[model samples]
Target: MTTEVSTRPLQTLLAFPFHEDRWQSKMLIGIGLTLAGMIIPIIPGLILMGYVYQIMHRVIVDRGSLYLPEWDNWGKFLKDGWRLFCVAFLYSLPTLVVSFAGMGIYIVTFIGAMTAAGNHPDSPASILLFVAIGILFLSIGLSILTGTLTFLVLPAALGHTVARDSFSAGFDFTGWWKIFRANTGGFLIALLVITGLMGLVYIVSQIFSMTIVLICLIVLLPLAVGFYVMLIGAALVAGAYREGVENLELAELKLAEASIVAVQEEKPS
Candidate 1:
């Protein structure tokens, strides 16, 4: 008998991080991403991100089991991590560029406004105050909206990249849109779940400072928590993407069966 695929988003989301089956191995991977790799004084954090990307790839495409990633393959982890970085960097670029450009424009215009106010005593002080307030509100509003959008679409986009095994796949708008449409609610919940988990990780790391020694806590707790958070994020995303992939597989299977039936009907009796 075939095993029932764990495609339910919420159940899939909880399984990787919390399931008793392979928790120890998962924790070891978290260490490799965080504390263990940091021993080399290189960008282990980035390498860890790549490692996380591989896990998402396995779940979304290979339908591989969700368990701890083996830490033995340093080279492979770094390469995959780099690919993940490239994809995410592309996703985040537009917001970064717009934010910088806006801030630059605001600074230049604010300086001009200040100069004008000084030169003309009749200038309304309220105008300067309004611009300051406007810029503040604008910056905050843009940040929130952009961040939410980026996070909301991230899992689907990343999943597509993994499914296709190419960086270019991340930009496949039509493909990712279908996946996103299939799992809208799952993606949203994954985003919320990930955001909260990250915050909790940070808080735990901070709390350790008071309860434990500073150097030891920093060396041990934070990086471990960071890696664990990364694992959880992957699980959450994989859960959402699983729905799309399973649907896609089912459709393809049905189409194949239909084609087979048509061929038989066309055969000479």
Candidate 2:
């Protein structure tokens, strides 16, 4: 007999992190690690990221289990975190290149416009200014669009990488796209859920900022909120991935293949 797994995105996203018996302790540890990451920079940050990757991995393997893993394996966390960082950095390259190129062009055009205006106001300085402004807006628009698309697609890419336990898996665009297309709605809902939660966190942080006495919390609050949000986001990714796998019937196929391999190995050996 097998237990049925629930891949309902809303429930998974909202309840998974808190369903465990030691949830508060786990959350506090996560928050502390996150705060330490922010305070100490690169190494701690990578470990935190790796820890989040483990969360995603657990969800995917266990079919969205509610139990959080203890933070005992620092070495694994560091390695996983490094893999995640590499994948993220590679994905972000396009956006970074576009943004830098746009900024460079904007700076040149603005300087040209200013030079024209100073040298000859009656000349095509107005034209140059208009061109500069247009370029600026276009650059800004393109950057935002590129960045937004990257943001939306990255979680699935990360999920794939972790699922396969290979960094190269993240670059398997075709595979991830099929997964994304199979359950586009689930992915979008996950994205929207994350965005809404992040916005709420920002608002709460801002409210805390207004209170002078709680000024110290203004710094710590965002870090804690961001880590918690990351956990929720990771769970959502797992849920979406589970739904995608089921929708594509990959899980059963893999299981059948595994059973066949096991039988063949037993008979031959």
Q: Can you list the residue pairs that collide in candidate 1?
A: 50-81
Number of the top lDDT candidate: 2
Q: Per-prediction RMSD in angstroms?
A: 5.6, 6.7
What is the Cα-based lDDT of residue 77 in candidate 1? 77
TM-score of each: 0.74, 0.82
Please give the lDDT score at residue 80 for candidate 2: 96
Query: By TM-score, how accurate is candidate 2?
Result: 0.82
Error of 1 at 221 (Å): 3.1
